[model samples]
Target: MDKITIQNLEVYANHGVFPEETALGQKFLVCAELWTEIRTAGRTDDLEYSINYGTVCQEITRFMKEHTSRLIEAVAEQLAEYLLQTLPLLKGITLEIKKPWAPVGLPLDTVSVKIERCWHRAYVAFGSNMGDRRSHIDSGIQVLRDDPAIRVGSISDMIVTEPYGGVEQEDFLNGCLELETLLTPMELLAVLQKAEQKENRERLVHWGPRTLDMDLLFYDDEVLEEPELAVPHPEIPKRRFVLEPLSQIAPYKMHPVLKKRVKELLEELSDRE
Candidate 1:
Protein backbone atom coordinates (compact mmCIF):
# COMPACT_ATOMS: atom_id res chain seq x y z
CA MET A 1 0.00 0.00 0.00
CA ASP A 2 1.16 3.50 -0.85
CA LYS A 3 1.46 6.00 1.99
CA ILE A 4 1.54 9.74 2.60
CA THR A 5 3.49 10.68 5.69
CA ILE A 6 2.89 13.96 7.48
CA GLN A 7 5.25 14.35 10.39
CA ASN A 8 5.21 16.52 13.48
CA LEU A 9 2.65 19.05 12.36
CA GLU A 10 2.52 21.68 15.05
CA VAL A 11 -0.72 22.58 16.79
CA TYR A 12 -1.45 24.84 19.75
CA ALA A 13 -4.22 23.16 21.65
CA ASN A 14 -5.80 23.11 25.09
CA HIS A 15 -5.55 19.44 26.08
CA GLY A 16 -4.31 17.91 29.30
CA VAL A 17 -5.14 16.39 32.67
CA PHE A 18 -4.14 19.43 34.65
CA PRO A 19 -6.35 22.49 34.51
CA GLU A 20 -3.26 24.64 33.95
CA GLU A 21 -2.44 22.77 30.76
CA THR A 22 -5.85 23.42 29.27
CA ALA A 23 -6.14 26.99 30.54
CA LEU A 24 -2.67 28.07 29.55
CA GLY A 25 -2.74 25.99 26.37
CA GLN A 26 0.19 23.90 25.15
CA LYS A 27 2.03 22.71 22.09
CA PHE A 28 0.93 19.35 20.70
CA LEU A 29 2.37 17.72 17.61
CA VAL A 30 0.54 15.26 15.40
CA CYS A 31 1.99 12.81 12.92
CA ALA A 32 -0.08 10.82 10.48
CA GLU A 33 0.63 8.22 7.84
CA LEU A 34 -2.25 7.77 5.43
CA TRP A 35 -2.40 4.48 3.54
CA THR A 36 -3.87 4.88 0.08
CA GLU A 37 -3.39 4.27 -3.60
CA ILE A 38 -1.33 7.09 -5.09
CA ARG A 39 -0.13 5.37 -8.23
CA THR A 40 -2.73 7.03 -10.40
CA ALA A 41 -1.90 10.38 -8.96
CA GLY A 42 1.78 9.74 -9.56
CA ARG A 43 1.24 8.60 -13.16
CA THR A 44 -1.14 11.35 -14.16
CA ASP A 45 0.32 14.08 -11.97
CA ASP A 46 -3.30 14.81 -11.14
CA LEU A 47 -4.34 16.26 -7.83
CA GLU A 48 -7.76 14.58 -8.08
CA TYR A 49 -6.29 11.11 -8.03
CA SER A 50 -4.42 11.58 -4.75
CA ILE A 51 -4.93 12.71 -1.20
CA ASN A 52 -3.95 16.29 -0.46
CA TYR A 53 -1.47 16.45 2.42
CA GLY A 54 -1.90 20.21 2.68
CA THR A 55 -5.59 19.75 3.36
CA VAL A 56 -4.90 16.95 5.86
CA CYS A 57 -2.50 19.15 7.79
CA GLN A 58 -5.06 21.92 7.97
CA GLU A 59 -7.75 19.54 9.14
CA ILE A 60 -5.50 18.06 11.80
CA THR A 61 -4.67 21.48 13.17
CA ARG A 62 -8.30 22.49 13.19
CA PHE A 63 -9.38 19.27 14.88
CA MET A 64 -6.77 19.54 17.61
CA LYS A 65 -7.65 23.16 18.34
CA GLU A 66 -11.36 22.49 18.48
CA HIS A 67 -11.32 19.44 20.77
CA THR A 68 -10.12 19.37 24.38
CA SER A 69 -9.28 15.94 25.73
CA ARG A 70 -7.51 14.95 28.90
CA LEU A 71 -5.56 12.18 27.28
CA ILE A 72 -3.53 12.02 24.08
CA GLU A 73 -4.77 8.48 23.64
CA ALA A 74 -8.27 9.76 23.09
CA VAL A 75 -6.94 12.43 20.82
CA ALA A 76 -5.08 9.97 18.64
CA GLU A 77 -7.98 7.54 18.49
CA GLN A 78 -10.47 10.22 17.55
CA LEU A 79 -8.10 11.80 15.09
CA ALA A 80 -7.53 8.49 13.37
CA GLU A 81 -11.26 7.92 13.11
CA TYR A 82 -11.79 11.45 11.91
CA LEU A 83 -9.18 11.19 9.21
CA LEU A 84 -10.38 7.78 8.08
CA GLN A 85 -13.92 9.10 7.75
CA THR A 86 -12.91 12.42 6.27
CA LEU A 87 -10.49 11.00 3.77
CA PRO A 88 -12.42 8.60 1.60
CA LEU A 89 -9.30 7.46 -0.21
CA LEU A 90 -7.45 6.40 2.94
CA LYS A 91 -7.51 2.70 3.74
CA GLY A 92 -5.74 3.17 7.06
CA ILE A 93 -4.03 5.64 9.35
CA THR A 94 -0.97 5.53 11.54
CA LEU A 95 -1.34 8.35 14.04
CA GLU A 96 0.81 9.76 16.80
CA ILE A 97 -0.17 12.42 19.30
CA LYS A 98 2.93 13.94 20.84
CA LYS A 99 2.94 15.96 24.04
CA PRO A 100 6.19 17.61 24.93
CA TRP A 101 7.09 19.46 28.12
CA ALA A 102 5.01 17.63 30.67
CA PRO A 103 4.06 18.81 34.16
CA VAL A 104 5.22 15.55 35.73
CA GLY A 105 8.47 17.29 36.75
CA LEU A 106 10.41 14.28 35.51
CA PRO A 107 12.90 15.05 32.78
CA LEU A 108 11.76 13.20 29.71
CA ASP A 109 11.77 13.41 25.96
CA THR A 110 8.20 13.38 24.59
CA VAL A 111 5.06 11.58 25.69
CA SER A 112 3.05 10.24 22.80
CA VAL A 113 0.62 7.51 21.85
CA LYS A 114 0.99 5.88 18.48
CA ILE A 115 -1.48 3.55 16.85
CA GLU A 116 -1.83 1.79 13.52
CA ARG A 117 -5.42 1.51 12.39
CA CYS A 118 -6.48 -0.02 9.10
CA TRP A 119 -9.52 -1.32 7.32
CA HIS A 120 -9.74 -5.10 7.50
CA ARG A 121 -12.12 -7.31 5.58
CA ALA A 122 -14.11 -9.83 7.61
CA TYR A 123 -16.74 -12.41 6.76
CA VAL A 124 -19.40 -12.99 9.38
CA ALA A 125 -22.05 -15.65 9.46
CA PHE A 126 -25.32 -15.12 11.28
CA GLY A 127 -28.40 -17.07 12.18
CA SER A 128 -31.59 -16.78 14.17
CA ASN A 129 -33.82 -19.61 15.34
CA MET A 130 -36.06 -17.86 17.85
CA GLY A 131 -38.90 -15.45 17.25
CA ASP A 132 -38.81 -13.18 14.21
CA ARG A 133 -35.68 -14.76 12.80
CA ARG A 134 -35.37 -12.60 9.75
CA SER A 135 -35.86 -9.48 11.82
CA HIS A 136 -33.01 -10.46 14.11
CA ILE A 137 -30.66 -11.09 11.23
CA ASP A 138 -31.69 -7.92 9.41
CA SER A 139 -31.34 -5.86 12.56
CA GLY A 140 -27.81 -7.22 13.04
CA ILE A 141 -26.94 -6.25 9.48
CA GLN A 142 -28.36 -2.77 9.99
CA VAL A 143 -26.38 -2.32 13.19
CA LEU A 144 -23.12 -3.12 11.43
CA ARG A 145 -24.00 -0.91 8.45
CA ASP A 146 -24.86 2.04 10.64
CA ASP A 147 -21.57 1.94 12.54
CA PRO A 148 -19.10 4.57 11.28
CA ALA A 149 -16.11 2.23 11.15
CA ILE A 150 -17.88 -0.70 9.56
CA ARG A 151 -18.64 -0.96 5.86
CA VAL A 152 -21.12 -3.75 5.16
CA GLY A 153 -20.41 -5.28 1.78
CA SER A 154 -22.06 -8.32 0.20
CA ILE A 155 -24.88 -10.00 2.13
CA SER A 156 -26.18 -13.39 1.12
CA ASP A 157 -29.80 -14.34 0.95
CA MET A 158 -31.22 -15.86 4.11
CA ILE A 159 -31.60 -19.59 3.87
CA VAL A 160 -33.59 -21.71 6.28
CA THR A 161 -31.62 -24.60 7.65
CA GLU A 162 -31.79 -27.22 10.37
CA PRO A 163 -30.07 -26.41 13.62
CA TYR A 164 -26.68 -27.95 14.41
CA GLY A 165 -25.03 -29.29 17.59
CA GLY A 166 -27.73 -31.93 18.10
CA VAL A 167 -29.92 -29.40 19.78
CA GLU A 168 -33.58 -29.77 19.04
CA GLN A 169 -34.73 -26.32 18.02
CA GLU A 170 -36.67 -24.34 15.52
CA ASP A 171 -35.24 -24.00 12.03
CA PHE A 172 -32.69 -21.24 11.72
CA LEU A 173 -32.45 -18.50 9.14
CA ASN A 174 -28.82 -18.47 8.17
CA GLY A 175 -26.77 -16.13 6.00
CA CYS A 176 -23.40 -14.49 5.62
CA LEU A 177 -22.29 -10.85 5.61
CA GLU A 178 -19.10 -9.23 4.40
CA LEU A 179 -17.67 -6.30 6.30
CA GLU A 180 -14.76 -3.89 6.13
CA THR A 181 -13.76 -2.62 9.53
CA LEU A 182 -11.04 -0.71 11.34
CA LEU A 183 -11.60 -2.58 14.59
CA THR A 184 -9.22 -5.33 15.60
CA PRO A 185 -10.49 -8.92 15.80
CA MET A 186 -11.44 -8.74 19.48
CA GLU A 187 -13.03 -5.36 19.11
CA LEU A 188 -15.09 -6.59 16.19
CA LEU A 189 -16.21 -9.57 18.27
CA ALA A 190 -17.43 -7.22 20.97
CA VAL A 191 -19.41 -5.32 18.40
CA LEU A 192 -20.94 -8.52 17.14
CA GLN A 193 -21.87 -9.48 20.69
CA LYS A 194 -23.53 -6.12 21.13
CA ALA A 195 -25.70 -6.77 18.10
CA GLU A 196 -26.57 -10.20 19.41
CA GLN A 197 -27.49 -8.83 22.81
CA LYS A 198 -29.74 -6.29 21.16
CA GLU A 199 -31.72 -9.21 19.79
CA ASN A 200 -31.80 -10.94 23.19
CA ARG A 201 -29.41 -13.71 22.28
CA GLU A 202 -29.08 -16.31 25.02
CA ARG A 203 -26.40 -18.82 25.95
CA LEU A 204 -28.52 -21.13 28.05
CA VAL A 205 -27.57 -24.08 25.89
CA HIS A 206 -24.77 -24.91 23.54
CA TRP A 207 -25.79 -24.29 19.94
CA GLY A 208 -29.10 -23.56 21.47
CA PRO A 209 -32.02 -21.57 20.17
CA ARG A 210 -31.30 -17.87 20.24
CA THR A 211 -32.61 -14.63 18.88
CA LEU A 212 -29.34 -14.13 17.04
CA ASP A 213 -26.08 -16.00 16.51
CA MET A 214 -23.12 -14.47 14.77
CA ASP A 215 -19.60 -15.73 14.20
CA LEU A 216 -16.54 -14.29 12.60
CA LEU A 217 -15.88 -16.69 9.74
CA PHE A 218 -12.88 -14.97 8.22
CA TYR A 219 -10.88 -11.79 8.60
CA ASP A 220 -8.66 -10.56 5.77
CA ASP A 221 -7.47 -14.09 5.05
CA GLU A 222 -6.15 -14.00 8.57
CA VAL A 223 -5.85 -17.09 10.73
CA LEU A 224 -6.13 -15.93 14.28
CA GLU A 225 -6.09 -17.96 17.45
CA GLU A 226 -6.75 -15.93 20.52
CA PRO A 227 -8.38 -16.26 23.88
CA GLU A 228 -11.70 -14.91 22.59
CA LEU A 229 -11.50 -14.79 18.82
CA ALA A 230 -10.68 -17.19 15.97
CA VAL A 231 -10.39 -16.32 12.33
CA PRO A 232 -11.01 -18.60 9.35
CA HIS A 233 -13.61 -19.95 11.72
CA PRO A 234 -12.79 -23.38 13.08
CA GLU A 235 -15.83 -24.94 11.44
CA ILE A 236 -16.21 -23.03 8.18
CA PRO A 237 -15.76 -26.14 6.09
CA LYS A 238 -17.94 -28.42 8.19
CA ARG A 239 -21.06 -26.31 8.35
CA ARG A 240 -23.15 -26.11 5.21
CA PHE A 241 -25.25 -23.40 6.79
CA VAL A 242 -22.19 -21.18 6.93
CA LEU A 243 -20.50 -22.11 3.67
CA GLU A 244 -23.67 -22.01 1.58
CA PRO A 245 -24.30 -18.33 2.08
CA LEU A 246 -20.62 -17.49 2.32
CA SER A 247 -20.09 -19.03 -1.07
CA GLN A 248 -22.77 -16.86 -2.58
CA ILE A 249 -20.85 -13.67 -1.88
CA ALA A 250 -17.25 -14.83 -1.66
CA PRO A 251 -17.01 -18.02 -3.63
CA TYR A 252 -13.40 -17.56 -4.56
CA LYS A 253 -12.27 -16.14 -1.25
CA MET A 254 -9.60 -18.47 0.12
CA HIS A 255 -9.14 -19.79 3.61
CA PRO A 256 -5.73 -18.62 4.69
CA VAL A 257 -4.96 -21.71 6.72
CA LEU A 258 -6.77 -24.36 4.73
CA LYS A 259 -5.91 -22.85 1.35
CA LYS A 260 -9.33 -23.73 0.03
CA ARG A 261 -11.89 -21.56 -1.66
CA VAL A 262 -15.38 -21.11 -0.25
CA LYS A 263 -16.90 -22.77 -3.28
CA GLU A 264 -14.62 -25.73 -2.95
CA LEU A 265 -15.43 -26.16 0.69
CA LEU A 266 -19.12 -25.93 -0.01
CA GLU A 267 -18.77 -28.55 -2.74
CA GLU A 268 -16.83 -30.94 -0.54
CA LEU A 269 -19.34 -30.56 2.25
CA SER A 270 -22.17 -31.21 -0.17
CA ASP A 271 -20.53 -34.36 -1.45
CA ARG A 272 -20.29 -35.71 2.07
CA GLU A 273 -23.99 -35.04 2.66
Candidate 2:
Protein backbone atom coordinates (compact mmCIF):
# COMPACT_ATOMS: atom_id res chain seq x y z
CA MET A 1 0.00 0.00 0.00
CA ASP A 2 1.18 3.54 -0.75
CA LYS A 3 1.35 6.10 2.04
CA ILE A 4 0.34 9.74 2.36
CA THR A 5 1.38 11.18 5.68
CA ILE A 6 -0.03 14.48 6.94
CA GLN A 7 1.49 15.41 10.25
CA ASN A 8 0.55 17.85 13.03
CA LEU A 9 -2.01 19.90 11.19
CA GLU A 10 -3.12 22.62 13.60
CA VAL A 11 -6.74 23.28 14.51
CA TYR A 12 -8.51 25.46 17.08
CA ALA A 13 -11.41 23.45 18.45
CA ASN A 14 -13.46 23.08 21.60
CA HIS A 15 -13.00 19.53 22.85
CA GLY A 16 -12.47 18.42 26.43
CA VAL A 17 -14.15 17.12 29.57
CA PHE A 18 -14.12 20.40 31.41
CA PRO A 19 -16.76 23.05 30.61
CA GLU A 20 -14.09 25.77 30.45
CA GLU A 21 -12.25 23.89 27.73
CA THR A 22 -15.28 24.08 25.47
CA ALA A 23 -15.97 27.69 26.38
CA LEU A 24 -12.40 28.97 26.02
CA GLY A 25 -11.48 26.59 23.18
CA GLN A 26 -8.06 24.95 22.67
CA LYS A 27 -5.56 23.90 20.04
CA PHE A 28 -5.44 20.38 18.63
CA LEU A 29 -2.90 18.71 16.41
CA VAL A 30 -3.86 15.93 14.05
CA CYS A 31 -1.81 13.43 12.08
CA ALA A 32 -3.22 11.09 9.47
CA GLU A 33 -1.82 8.36 7.27
CA LEU A 34 -3.93 7.64 4.23
CA TRP A 35 -3.42 4.30 2.51
CA THR A 36 -4.06 3.75 -1.20
CA GLU A 37 -2.60 2.61 -4.50
CA ILE A 38 -0.28 5.28 -5.93
CA ARG A 39 1.21 3.48 -8.86
CA THR A 40 -0.97 5.13 -11.49
CA ALA A 41 -0.64 8.53 -9.89
CA GLY A 42 3.12 8.17 -9.74
CA ARG A 43 3.33 7.11 -13.40
CA THR A 44 0.98 9.75 -14.74
CA ASP A 45 1.86 12.54 -12.29
CA ASP A 46 -1.88 13.11 -12.03
CA LEU A 47 -3.79 14.28 -8.97
CA GLU A 48 -6.84 12.37 -10.19
CA TYR A 49 -5.10 9.01 -9.92
CA SER A 50 -3.96 9.54 -6.32
CA ILE A 51 -5.47 11.18 -3.25
CA ASN A 52 -4.78 14.91 -3.06
CA TYR A 53 -2.93 15.81 0.13
CA GLY A 54 -3.86 19.48 -0.23
CA THR A 55 -7.55 18.61 -0.42
CA VAL A 56 -7.25 16.30 2.59
CA CYS A 57 -5.57 19.04 4.65
CA GLN A 58 -8.29 21.51 3.74
CA GLU A 59 -10.91 18.92 4.60
CA ILE A 60 -9.38 18.31 8.00
CA THR A 61 -9.22 22.02 8.77
CA ARG A 62 -12.81 22.56 7.72
CA PHE A 63 -14.09 19.51 9.60
CA MET A 64 -12.30 20.39 12.85
CA LYS A 65 -13.60 23.94 12.82
CA GLU A 66 -17.16 23.00 11.91
CA HIS A 67 -17.62 19.85 14.01
CA THR A 68 -16.90 20.25 17.71
CA SER A 69 -17.10 17.30 20.07
CA ARG A 70 -16.51 16.94 23.80
CA LEU A 71 -13.75 14.39 23.35
CA ILE A 72 -10.92 14.05 20.87
CA GLU A 73 -11.70 10.34 20.71
CA ALA A 74 -15.03 11.09 19.08
CA VAL A 75 -13.38 13.68 16.85
CA ALA A 76 -10.77 11.18 15.68
CA GLU A 77 -13.32 8.46 15.00
CA GLN A 78 -15.66 10.73 13.04
CA LEU A 79 -12.76 12.27 11.12
CA ALA A 80 -11.33 8.87 10.19
CA GLU A 81 -14.75 7.72 9.02
CA TYR A 82 -15.22 10.92 7.07
CA LEU A 83 -11.86 10.58 5.33
CA LEU A 84 -12.60 6.98 4.41
CA GLN A 85 -16.03 7.91 3.05
CA THR A 86 -14.88 10.96 1.16
CA LEU A 87 -11.65 9.57 -0.29
CA PRO A 88 -12.70 6.95 -2.82
CA LEU A 89 -9.16 5.79 -3.48
CA LEU A 90 -8.25 5.31 0.15
CA LYS A 91 -8.29 1.83 1.69
CA GLY A 92 -7.41 2.62 5.34
CA ILE A 93 -6.56 5.40 7.78
CA THR A 94 -4.34 5.75 10.81
CA LEU A 95 -5.46 8.82 12.74
CA GLU A 96 -3.72 10.40 15.69
CA ILE A 97 -5.50 13.17 17.59
CA LYS A 98 -3.20 15.15 19.86
CA LYS A 99 -4.22 17.33 22.74
CA PRO A 100 -1.09 19.19 23.74
CA TRP A 101 -2.51 21.76 26.12
CA ALA A 102 -4.62 19.33 28.11
CA PRO A 103 -5.44 20.61 31.60
CA VAL A 104 -3.56 17.94 33.44
CA GLY A 105 -1.54 20.46 35.55
CA LEU A 106 1.65 18.46 35.05
CA PRO A 107 4.70 18.44 32.83
CA LEU A 108 3.71 16.07 30.04
CA ASP A 109 4.31 15.67 26.30
CA THR A 110 0.82 15.20 24.83
CA VAL A 111 -2.38 13.22 25.18
CA SER A 112 -3.72 11.54 22.11
CA VAL A 113 -5.67 8.61 20.81
CA LYS A 114 -4.53 6.72 17.74
CA ILE A 115 -6.54 4.19 15.80
CA GLU A 116 -6.15 2.15 12.65
CA ARG A 117 -9.36 1.51 10.72
CA CYS A 118 -9.69 -0.40 7.47
CA TRP A 119 -12.15 -2.32 5.33
CA HIS A 120 -12.66 -6.03 5.95
CA ARG A 121 -13.94 -8.88 3.79
CA ALA A 122 -16.79 -10.88 5.23
CA TYR A 123 -19.01 -13.76 4.14
CA VAL A 124 -22.62 -13.99 5.23
CA ALA A 125 -25.13 -16.81 5.00
CA PHE A 126 -28.77 -16.03 4.29
CA GLY A 127 -31.68 -18.34 4.86
CA SER A 128 -35.42 -18.28 5.32
CA ASN A 129 -37.87 -21.13 5.79
CA MET A 130 -41.06 -19.22 6.52
CA GLY A 131 -43.39 -17.07 4.45
CA ASP A 132 -42.01 -15.03 1.57
CA ARG A 133 -38.61 -16.63 1.83
CA ARG A 134 -37.28 -15.13 -1.36
CA SER A 135 -38.58 -11.70 -0.41
CA HIS A 136 -36.90 -11.98 2.96
CA ILE A 137 -33.54 -12.71 1.35
CA ASP A 138 -34.01 -9.90 -1.18
CA SER A 139 -34.82 -7.44 1.56
CA GLY A 140 -31.62 -8.31 3.38
CA ILE A 141 -29.61 -7.83 0.19
CA GLN A 142 -31.20 -4.43 -0.35
CA VAL A 143 -30.31 -3.33 3.16
CA LEU A 144 -26.65 -4.28 2.65
CA ARG A 145 -26.58 -2.53 -0.72
CA ASP A 146 -28.02 0.61 0.87
CA ASP A 147 -25.17 0.84 3.37
CA PRO A 148 -22.18 2.96 2.31
CA ALA A 149 -19.46 0.93 3.97
CA ILE A 150 -20.72 -2.46 2.81
CA ARG A 151 -20.16 -3.48 -0.82
CA VAL A 152 -21.99 -6.57 -2.06
CA GLY A 153 -19.47 -8.53 -4.09
CA SER A 154 -21.25 -11.68 -5.22
CA ILE A 155 -24.26 -13.79 -4.30
CA SER A 156 -24.85 -17.49 -4.85
CA ASP A 157 -28.05 -18.71 -6.46
CA MET A 158 -30.52 -19.57 -3.76
CA ILE A 159 -30.69 -23.30 -3.14
CA VAL A 160 -33.50 -25.17 -1.47
CA THR A 161 -32.05 -27.23 1.37
CA GLU A 162 -33.60 -29.69 3.79
CA PRO A 163 -33.79 -28.67 7.43
CA TYR A 164 -30.63 -29.53 9.36
CA GLY A 165 -31.75 -29.84 13.00
CA GLY A 166 -34.15 -32.41 14.44
CA VAL A 167 -37.00 -29.88 14.59
CA GLU A 168 -39.16 -30.34 11.50
CA GLN A 169 -39.62 -27.26 9.33
CA GLU A 170 -40.17 -26.27 5.73
CA ASP A 171 -37.24 -26.40 3.30
CA PHE A 172 -35.02 -23.35 3.54
CA LEU A 173 -33.78 -21.06 0.80
CA ASN A 174 -30.09 -20.71 1.59
CA GLY A 175 -27.17 -18.92 -0.03
CA CYS A 176 -23.98 -17.02 0.79
CA LEU A 177 -22.73 -13.49 0.23
CA GLU A 178 -19.34 -11.84 -0.24
CA LEU A 179 -19.11 -8.37 1.28
CA GLU A 180 -16.40 -5.72 1.58
CA THR A 181 -17.05 -3.59 4.63
CA LEU A 182 -15.58 -1.01 6.98
CA LEU A 183 -17.47 -2.50 9.91
CA THR A 184 -15.70 -4.62 12.52
CA PRO A 185 -16.82 -8.18 13.16
CA MET A 186 -18.99 -7.11 16.09
CA GLU A 187 -20.43 -4.15 14.21
CA LEU A 188 -21.22 -6.43 11.27
CA LEU A 189 -23.00 -8.77 13.68
CA ALA A 190 -25.09 -5.89 14.92
CA VAL A 191 -26.11 -5.08 11.37
CA LEU A 192 -27.09 -8.70 10.75
CA GLN A 193 -29.07 -8.85 14.00
CA LYS A 194 -30.81 -5.60 13.13
CA ALA A 195 -31.88 -6.99 9.77
CA GLU A 196 -33.13 -10.19 11.38
CA GLN A 197 -35.03 -8.18 13.95
CA LYS A 198 -36.64 -6.12 11.20
CA GLU A 199 -37.98 -9.37 9.80
CA ASN A 200 -39.29 -10.26 13.29
CA ARG A 201 -36.95 -13.21 13.74
CA GLU A 202 -37.61 -14.92 17.02
CA ARG A 203 -35.74 -17.27 19.32
CA LEU A 204 -38.93 -19.01 20.41
CA VAL A 205 -38.28 -22.28 18.56
CA HIS A 206 -34.70 -23.36 18.01
CA TRP A 207 -34.06 -23.84 14.25
CA GLY A 208 -37.77 -23.30 13.67
CA PRO A 209 -39.30 -21.54 10.66
CA ARG A 210 -38.48 -17.86 10.40
CA THR A 211 -39.13 -14.87 8.18
CA LEU A 212 -35.43 -14.11 7.70
CA ASP A 213 -32.21 -15.71 8.90
CA MET A 214 -28.76 -14.16 8.59
CA ASP A 215 -25.52 -15.47 10.02
CA LEU A 216 -21.91 -14.30 9.91
CA LEU A 217 -20.14 -17.23 8.30
CA PHE A 218 -16.63 -15.75 8.04
CA TYR A 219 -14.76 -12.51 8.63
CA ASP A 220 -11.40 -12.07 6.87
CA ASP A 221 -10.21 -15.56 7.80
CA GLU A 222 -10.56 -14.53 11.42
CA VAL A 223 -11.25 -17.06 14.14
CA LEU A 224 -12.82 -15.96 17.36
CA GLU A 225 -14.96 -17.62 20.04
CA GLU A 226 -16.74 -15.09 22.13
CA PRO A 227 -19.83 -15.21 24.29
CA GLU A 228 -22.17 -13.71 21.73
CA LEU A 229 -20.45 -14.54 18.42
CA ALA A 230 -18.26 -17.12 16.71
CA VAL A 231 -16.15 -16.60 13.62
CA PRO A 232 -15.66 -18.99 10.64
CA HIS A 233 -19.09 -19.95 11.93
CA PRO A 234 -18.05 -23.30 13.62
CA GLU A 235 -20.06 -25.51 11.23
CA ILE A 236 -19.65 -23.77 7.86
CA PRO A 237 -17.20 -26.37 6.58
CA LYS A 238 -19.67 -29.17 7.20
CA ARG A 239 -22.66 -27.40 5.64
CA ARG A 240 -22.96 -27.72 1.86
CA PHE A 241 -25.25 -24.73 1.64
CA VAL A 242 -22.61 -22.52 3.22
CA LEU A 243 -19.70 -23.98 1.27
CA GLU A 244 -21.54 -23.83 -2.05
CA PRO A 245 -22.33 -20.16 -1.84
CA LEU A 246 -18.96 -19.29 -0.34
CA SER A 247 -17.12 -21.24 -3.04
CA GLN A 248 -18.87 -19.28 -5.73
CA ILE A 249 -17.08 -16.07 -4.78
CA ALA A 250 -14.05 -17.39 -2.88
CA PRO A 251 -13.46 -20.94 -4.01
CA TYR A 252 -9.77 -20.90 -3.18
CA LYS A 253 -9.98 -18.90 0.05
CA MET A 254 -8.19 -20.81 2.78
CA HIS A 255 -9.72 -21.29 6.19
CA PRO A 256 -7.62 -19.74 8.98
CA VAL A 257 -8.06 -22.71 11.30
CA LEU A 258 -8.65 -25.67 8.97
CA LYS A 259 -5.89 -24.71 6.51
CA LYS A 260 -8.00 -25.92 3.55
CA ARG A 261 -9.46 -23.95 0.67
CA VAL A 262 -13.22 -23.51 0.62
CA LYS A 263 -13.56 -25.48 -2.63
CA GLU A 264 -11.41 -28.33 -1.29
CA LEU A 265 -13.42 -28.54 1.93
CA LEU A 266 -16.68 -28.49 0.03
CA GLU A 267 -15.45 -31.34 -2.18
CA GLU A 268 -14.34 -33.37 0.80
CA LEU A 269 -17.65 -32.92 2.55
CA SER A 270 -19.52 -33.91 -0.62
CA ASP A 271 -17.40 -37.03 -0.95
CA ARG A 272 -18.33 -38.13 2.55
CA GLU A 273 -22.04 -37.38 2.34
TM-scores for all predictions: 0.92, 0.94
- Candidate 1 lDDT at 53 equals 98
Cα lDDT of model 2 by residue, 64-132, tens digit: 888889888899989988888788898999999999999999999999999998878899999999999
Give all candidates' CA lDDT scores.
0.91, 0.89
Worst 10-residue lDDT window for candidate 2 reads: 140-149
Model 2 quality (TM-score): 0.94
Could you say which candidate leads in lDDT?
Answer: 1
Candidate 1 Cα misplacement greater than 4 A, ranges: 106-109
